[model samples]
Target chain A: MTSGDRGIRGVDSAADDFVARRRGQASAPAAADRPGWRPTRALSRAFVVIAVASALGVLLGRVDLVILALPFIIGTAVALRSRPTALPTVTLQLGTDVGAEGGDVHARMRVANPGEVPLSTAVLRAGVSPWVRLRQGHGTYAASVGAEMGNSIVVAGRAMRWGAHFFGPVLADTYACDNLFHYETLPAEAKRVRTYPVGEPFSADEAMPRASGLGGTHRSRRPGEGGELAGVRPYQPGDRLRRIDWRVSMRARELYVNHTLSDRDAEVVLLLDVGVDAGTSGGVDGKASVLDTAVRATAAIAEHYLHRGDRVSCLEFGPRVRRLRPGTGRRHYLSTLEWLLGVRVADGVSSDTRLLRSGALPPNALVVMLTPLLDDSSLSALAGLARAGRFLVAVDTLPEHVRPEHDGVWSAHAERLWRLDRENAIGELREHGVPVVRWGGAGSLDQVLRDVTRMSASGKAMI
Target chain B: MNDSRLAQRYHQGRAWLRRTQPGAMAVRTSVYVTGFLAVVTAAAPAIGAARAAGFALVLPILPTVRPMKVWPTALIVTCVAVWALTGEHSYALAFLLGALLYTHHTSAAQAVTMRTDTYVTPEVVTGWARRTGLVLLAAAAASALVGLLPRLFGRTDAIAYGLAGLAAVVGLGGVLAWLVFRKL
Candidate 1:
């Protein structure tokens, strides 16, 4: 992939994109553009001086050829040094929010030499760890630093869609001065850019906290106030008459009244999916990238529960599992963000059997699980967990419809295998009475809750 | 975790080694070797002659050695030293020209090979060591080529400069090419 040919994979795509966007529009006078090309000019001067020196001494038969070229040599010497300060403005277009599933992020920057001196030639370089694929743009460039010239450069890639990704150090160098004697260089700086998560708002008005601890309209099995006359048993000496069921008394011709309790609060557990598919090679421009969407979705879900005073906890499971014990405060949100910021897909989703063990979960908690069901192992575990209790709500992290591509025989086989696993996973979840909500619907979390609420409204999720 | 942090920083430094394409490293190594050998000869003649003769023997075989990786870098250094010491001039100029004229083509080619092999099997465990033998013969040839420049280019007063410039251009060109395309 040397410059011997311009057919660089990612380089051309990026350059073409920029040219098209600008429509060849002229750039304003940039300091780097104007006479900032010290290296380029230096090379030009070096060549002229050498040519002048070579012609004179050799033609004159002078033995001091080296002495004559000394000045030119010194001129080229500056190329080896680093620059003190360079102005390069980088802006990221991380479209919309990070959301429950990560989205796309595009980073665009222009390197300008604002100083009055010309640049001979310079290379502005930023490092990339393969996670962010270099889709298009010049990671390194060869330019002639002339008086007043500005070059707009970009590095575009499929970045993880998570909330925020960190960029490593950037190094800028000029051509020819690669020799220590002549290099012009600049100091390095640490950069931190935040890619905010997408917020998926749910309808607050419709949500009545499950009347367990939080407020709700429905009466509960435990002692709580409600306007219902439930069945009553014969009062032991301490039993109140209000606890008697009058209708039973009328039917049996005996005095027995009814006792009633209101619904209790429901706990919301947001189980986020941290899968490899959620990461990008370069910029986070893909759909439902784990970092991009999961973090944002988790935040949104946390907000949904916290606003209602329902206890909320988050489970970010990928290669690593980050859990925040359930809480109902602003601090919980901050803690969740901290986890999101640090969330990285180490590998495939972990297949911890404990997560799948039925009846292992805390009691009376509504299970809100999110995942990109690419594998059956996670599905199986969730299904087993669902069988342990009702109140199972599964949020599918899959895009609206993703049909895996099969290019060759092996790939076709792989694709079929994946499809088989997918069908089986969903089927198992449904069988166990876990309500599954496929992503891509508006109000992703809310839709899942509402749809699951509708399909199994009367009974808790079947184990 | 602290150990991991230390490992991370350590890995970063090691990564820097990888980032420095083998060709550039070879050229740098050759320059240092040339300076070092010149000093060995100037400072301690017996050691210098022995060292020079030993390297001269290895220089030709370097390109075809069992491990070609170091052969190229070694060959380049030997070639530059050969010219500098052949028909000696003042000590300073000999050192300067000797250091400058080291042939980087051998190292450059080796870098390309490394990159290609890396693509095939990115694991660092055996990747760098795989084709080391294959590079030895090529490095030997490069050393021989530099040794011949004195005869071919003619050791006139301007001769070394031409040789040094040519070497510089070729070495820098390879680097510039790598910088532009991110591959050697």
Candidate 2:
């Protein structure tokens, strides 16, 4: 369920569909009829110069003026000899529609001359998203197309970030008759390339607080017919004969059976705080912002639990309050990654916390809230979820190097006081029995989950 | 308000120049320099007023600004007029000025068709160069024929020469009309 694994399966199909759709559209008659040859300003300028010089030479009887006009006449007549009747066809073909962050994407722009006349020259200009950088300088190119021939410009670049990025709205024009007549095509639509965030390796050895599903990998506390042995007791009426411990029965000279814990699944709810985001994002290879850390961490945790046969869901705690229903399997894991692509910070907006008490969240489910903890609303939401008896773990997603911008003399002192206040708020959250832990990739939640599981078993309530 | 509009236009022009590709910029620079040199050479022997006018007209061809569409043509015509008025019919100088004028015209056309950031391919450059060279050869041969015709007929038959010039103008006018009226 890693981003790379998902991309390998999804990339080819997505790219094929996009290319097929574009080709189908380009083959239509309307597309062909849209572009036609028109004379450029250069042609008019040349004609004007020739006409003016010829008029002057004839009126004044100056042979030198006529000599000056001779080149213009020859050049213009030679250029106008072979006029292109039809325009060239332009299409953009993408390497893949889906890719992982830092993965390379290849694109080819094809300009095909459909006319009997050869194109003297053709120019192509394309616009690209800042997230994708093409290897070939700027996206402008010029080339000559022979009669009934085509030219392809290959553009290769890396996907710098995680999102749906566009390759181009490519603008192409062809010149013919010695660059006299020009035909320009309407800009082609940009191709979308989805880059998924790469998740870090994560695993947790601790048991879930409660297991609900009938069949899974986790061991439950209730005694049942399963792998992990609970104890040996006198045989009951409904117990199977295979469960009998022969050694214990023979030594005691009585019928005895082995008791085992049931294997059941648990639900994991990932709650993301998008009220505020801090730090500058230098793309995948550089420093990550708060949102970046939360997204990557969430993907890792979801993958870990989903791979273990546990149901996982995601919720955005912002003005929008976006939610994904709980589901299990490889398909759900892919859907989660797709959903994380739209994560954005909405400042000056209050979060709607009514979802906590709306029964949308399962009481026994482990709720992991990813937040920067820079805003009061997120802290209050975490406190409310804990107060409602939901198993909650608040993962601090703020980058370590992030600091407040200084503008005044007291800015440094103000930032220090702010840091102290944030520390105190974290301490207060811990006292309220909501474990606030800084997100450290693998084994991050093991200690916290272990303690939560102990508290759940004893039926302890938060203070 | 006019000042603000001018400032806006100036900024826009600067931005366009900034985005111009290095190769395209070089070609444009060459056009400017060649055009300036041609005007100065043609006007060198003329009066101060004509030289001043020629120099002033050439200013619009500077690479620092977006070239005025008519300025190159205007500058060439002014310089040629100045040369004619000087009453010196030096064939070598006329051919030299003609070559420079042709170069400026073709380069200006190439430069305008391209965007500010266009990466001009070597094929396109070579193709233009080849075509220009061929046309220059044709123009040189035609010029030699024109120069020879006057010497052979002698300058004494002024009426016949004027009549022939008038007929040539009429024929060329017909051709120009046909080109303009034809489907483009």
Give the worst 10-residue stretch by lDDT in candidate 1 chain A: A1-10
For TM-score, the strongest prediction is 2
* DockQ of all predictions against the true structure, Cα-based: 0.02, 0.43
lDDT of 2 by residue, A1-463 (tens): 0011111123334444444443353322233455577776667767776777667776777777777777877788777766778768788899888998899989888899988888877877666656776666577787888899998888899987787777766767678877777777755667888888886788999989888776778888777757889999998899999999999999999999998998888999999988887887767887778888888899999999999999999988887778888988899999998898877776556553676645568888999999999889988888887787888899999888788878899999998999999999999999888898898999999999988888888774742
Q: What is the per-residue lDDT of model 1 for residues A1-463, given as tens digits with 9 covering 90 to 100?
A: 0011111123234434433332233222323344332223223333443454344434443323333233233323333233323433322222322322233434543445554434433444454323344454324333334334454445555544333443333444432222211232332332333444445664334343243564544445565455655556554576576666667788887766456665555567777656444322222343344344445556677776676567777776555566777776677766666565655555655654545432234555666777777655567657666665546677666554344555577987886787787777788777777767764434655655565555444555424
RMSD of 2: 6.3
User: In model 1, which regions exceed 4 Å deviation?
Assistant: A1-160, A172-187, A204-265, A275-286, A289-296, A329-331, A356-361, A409-421, A443-463, B1-184
On DockQ, the leading prediction is: 2
- Lowest lDDT sum, 10 consecutive residues, model 2 chain A, at A1-10
Taking every candidate in turn, the Cα RMSD to the unseen true structure, in Å, is 18.0, 6.3
